[model samples]
Target: MTNVASPVAVVTTMDGRRPYGTTVSAFASLSLAPPMVLVSLDDRSQQLAIIRRTGRFGLNILSTRQAALAAAFARSGPDKFEGVAWSPSEGLPRLPDSAAWIAAEVDDYISAGDHTILLAQAVTAESAEGSPGPLTYHQRSFGTHTPLAP
Candidate 1:
């Protein structure tokens, strides 16, 4: 629902030659014992096809300051990584400065309506130092979390 705010994540995967990424707000942790996660992508997305083919992906949890980066990835038809600083983690491209990142291997794909849900196992994960907070999507707008004082 639009009323429910969700954390924003960029899903990245190599398409044989170049890396492809997209801003995704439908990511969630599915398990901790096996370190699993899930992300939903549009059925028609090229990036989704790449992930399916490669069987690997990286989920970068954006920091509040990275809202512009989120917008860049959300757009279609352009090099999303152009001028963006990033590096590879376990062969998957990752935003080195993101709040957190997970390198995952797709375990299953479930078709649901117009989207495909990827159930993955987190092969590796790490958190950046001094992250301000996570970027969030609410009512089609980007925002950040605020702490309440005692």
Candidate 2:
């Protein structure tokens, strides 16, 4: 049994078509000097094809309200973005009403074990005003984070 822990944001990458992205958790920031980040995608993942070919991707951060949406794409099934609302802006895939989103161009790709590390530059970001929680994955399921009282 997987142990549940602190939740982490669920992200969807609309990086490319051939290897289109979906729910991924191995997303994180790698540096801040020039603003760089890394997303770890499975080597065998269909997403690798496009990410490798195009050298660019989108990171659509999921809001807490999108737990179901996150789970929908996370689950083992096809047509992940079939009914999802997305558009190609600036020739990049973008999601509407996301908690926040980032567009990054691949800086470097590193092969590590079963996953490939995509080092990218944060191009732009968008978010809904006010504040919203995030959809997090811990152990295995989609869960919300409980902020500790300050």
TM-score against truth, every candidate: 0.96, 0.83
- Compared to the true structure, candidate 2 yields what TM-score? 0.83
lDDT of each: 0.93, 0.69
Best by TM-score: 1
In candidate 2, what are the lDDT values of residues 1-150, reduced to their tens digit?
356443343334444352244677777777788787788877877666766777778787777777777767666654677777777754666666667777888989999999888899988766667647666777777777787999
Give the per-residue lDDT of model 1 (tens digit) for 48-72.
8889889999999999999999999
Write down the lDDT that model 2 would get.
0.69
